[model samples]
Target chain A: MNYRIVTNNPSVKEVYKDIIFVNGTFLDVLINVRDLVHKGHELISHPLGSSIRTMYSPYRSIIVRNKTNEINKDHIEVIENSIYSYKNTMQRRKPDAVNSKDYAMLDLNLLKSALDEFKSIYDY
Target chain B: MKLELGRIYIKDIQFGNKTHVNNGTLIVNSQELIDKLKEDERVKDVKVDIARPGEKVRIIPVKDVIEPRVKIEGKGHGFAGVTSKTEQLGEGKVNVLYGAAVVTVGDIVGFQEGVIDMWGEGAKWTPFSKTCNLVVDITPIEGLQPHNHEAAVRIAGLKAAEYLGEAGRNVEPEEVLTYEIGTHTEEEAKYPDLPKVAYVEMLISQGLLHDGYIYGVNSQNILPTLLHPNEELDNAVISGNCVAACDKITTYQHQNNSVILDLYAQHGKTINFMGVILTPELTTLEGKFRTCDYTVKLCKMLGVDGVIISEEGYGNPDSDLLMICKRLEKENIKTVLITDECSGWDGMSQPLADTAKEAVAVVSTGNVSHVVTLPPADKVVGNAAAIATLAGGWEGSLEADGTIKCELNAVIGATSEIGYHNCTVNLY
Candidate 1:
């Protein structure tokens, strides 16, 4: 499926581009991003015009876990979206992470819709 | 001829020389000689003269009777006079008439005259010359013996219990749980901050819960999306999913247990069906639904006594109903499935009733218990009562009550009196 990254930030565009190219898709890139976010990683950025520059540090420090886990691909996508949403909400409220919500609400609707779509295609 | 008690007198005494006795003379009275020697030849021309108290009479030839050589027959025969006019001697001993030498206990002796008195004089009597032996014969009488199925069931149950514990837990049995998910309807109502809520009630009334645990899964809140970011949500989803999966597995295990019990109970086991039913609402997506054969086979495998299916509000028959009947018949399982529409009556459809009749007929012919059609939901109790009446007797009358009390009464009464030896109403 074709994926696109939409943001007004010129500096963050380079970071999103690098992730998309390296992971081949927004979903694949989000998996690494979510793990970093869960482990207390922070994104540093500066505003350019009306947008802010966002940087994604490489996940060189995150341990490589067992590769044979059977968690559904769709579940991974939801966790990724929740991570992004959490970071975005924190950035919108404050320039620095002085206070943060303990956990972000996962978008169940999006995940369910995606699942229903997948089921339709597979006819399962 | 008779002799004194101390004197030795021999008549018809065969020596090793094999000389036959001929004419002989006795020193006893003529009447005594005639009475002692019933054989005509023994006394035909023999003269018996009474001698002095213990004197012995000399055997002098009457005319030159060859000195009356003392030749005697080896065996002796005499007619013991009849007593009650009945042929007492020949009553059953028909083979005793053969002249076989047989020694018998008796007090009288023909050799002694005064030792044993003669009751009558000149009374003619015939004696059997050849020895006769008495023999008794016997013979035995044959018929049908019936077998006890209850005893068989008990023995099987005990043996099964030894090899297999109560629920066949030693080893995994086969899956007996067959279930059908009803067609999903539109959301009845939605909760304000919650994802659209749907009411999903399984249509499992068609199958039995005989020996298995049934788990209903409702993962309304633990959607996959909610599993992310929140540990609590994730935990809930994991727990619910585990329960759902485990319940399915356990149901299958118990289904197998029932089959083992049934094998012990009925001697045969088979799979009949395990599939879904097609309803009118599902017609648009007929191809989307699986067949009802699986459910039928599962029911048969588990030895389900009956199945109850809730009919859709519309008049269309549930496909599973017919499938259950046919498959149960094929596997020799007694089945009774009910539809919701027929709920007002005791789960009985003319078709279902007919099928039950046919199944019962087939099983009965093979010495197996017959199957009875359980009326649909509406007729369950009433039909049971009707069945009770037909069975007759006090037990049947009590069973007509259609209550737990009735079940107990019927069991106790039937088993005690008529020896009913199949599954009873109280067993379930």
Candidate 2:
């Protein structure tokens, strides 16, 4: 069970030692996810969450598994596109003020849903 | 499956002594209806109001919009399994109060709630503005979890629509719309020469404020499944999502799905309309792969020659949309997609979050980031200030002169990915 959680979610950071903690907005966290993909860590969850308004939230957490094989070009493309989308959305409407606890809670909930499915796949 | 809709056209609505439709006007017993919704223990209070087309009214921080309908010869009462439990749906008769809607407004989930204006420049952006909206504003009990808050309001909205729908149970409809599709094999044989067409409707099944329900079940937990479009059109499916207001398919949109209805219009004449493939836009990578693969597999199994796919929300589901399209095209199944864009307010950025060379036939349903200015309403139905926290609204979006400026993203149905909207793209 080797994985990493790239996140600005402080709750995930406090509990998970494998977290690559970020202190910026959702777009910044996505850029960090892109950097990991470039370093060959495959995505465990989609860089984008189930939310169409994910870019509106300042908090985010993405799951990934340790590199197993060669760099997956598709993962890189997905992350780059996600970053592009985030930038476009932010230009229109910026993320909620930092410490908007409700938005953070929502981001945590999204991570929890992804982690529930991730546990079943990564453990096997 | 064959379902007949008896539509009783409603042009005006007013609080009256009883609830009934009288010559195109819907009269509601305000106190009785408000009392009924308050019976739900999760709700602390209720406010009922009416906003008609061309009125100077603004409804804000809305949750869902549903058309009022009641079972005439249907197995289930109205919302099957939800409002009342009974046998399956899609083969029964239901009465629809045409041109009228029940709009739920609240701050349950906050950021994703939408706005609806009944007059002026804002009215041109959303379809709901054209309908005579019966607005219900509910407040949840203190300290309720976000999930409970969402459900309390969602179910309350459905119940409100069902309550009002009962008034049309026996009214004589202005017209009847019949949707009948035989089993896949039977249809294939009857229209042997016509192209076999199917519809793929992607639902945002993320939990909490983002979810769509099929027959009283959260779609996120289900796999890709086939359906008779009549089941959805008859109100078997519902929207419980608080996604971007511009693109979130309301329960009203589900009952009158433009894609499903338009396909029925071209049924035997142009194509052998198969049915709808219900797929979930889940939150995890594993679920995305599972559902997208399973969707195309079902289409391939049905021997589908052409397909129309519609997405519910944007961002992550953009990945799911392209994955399904890429797979269907690889199988030689002609594919067409309906989706909205997040290309910024200026429309300069890339439209979709993902892309496939195979998605050649695409339909862009307006830009969600397109900005609009709504004039102040003589009366506001819900909290107008709540927009500042909305996904598309920023601080100062509300002007001192009561002129509010916001993106189309804050306006409900302004960018319906289901093609249930007025915005269109013109090639120059």
Best by lDDT: 2
Cα lDDT tens digits for candidate 1, B223-290: 11111111110011111000011011111111122222222222112221221122111110121122
CA lDDT, every model vs. true structure:
0.20, 0.85
Docking class of 2: medium
In candidate 1, which residue ranges exceed 4 Å CA deviation?
Answer: A1-124, B1-260, B264-290, B293-318, B327-428
lDDT of 2 by residue, A62-115 (tens): 888797667889889989988887777777466666436777777777777677
Query: Could you tell me how far off, in angstroms, the CA of residue B393 lies in candidate 2 after the best superposition?
Result: 5.6
* Alpha-carbon RMSD to native, per candidate: 44.9, 1.8
lDDT of 1 at B113: 9
Q: Return the number of clashes found in candidate 2.
A: 0
Give the local distance difference test score of model 1: 0.20
Error of 2 at B315 (Å): 0.7
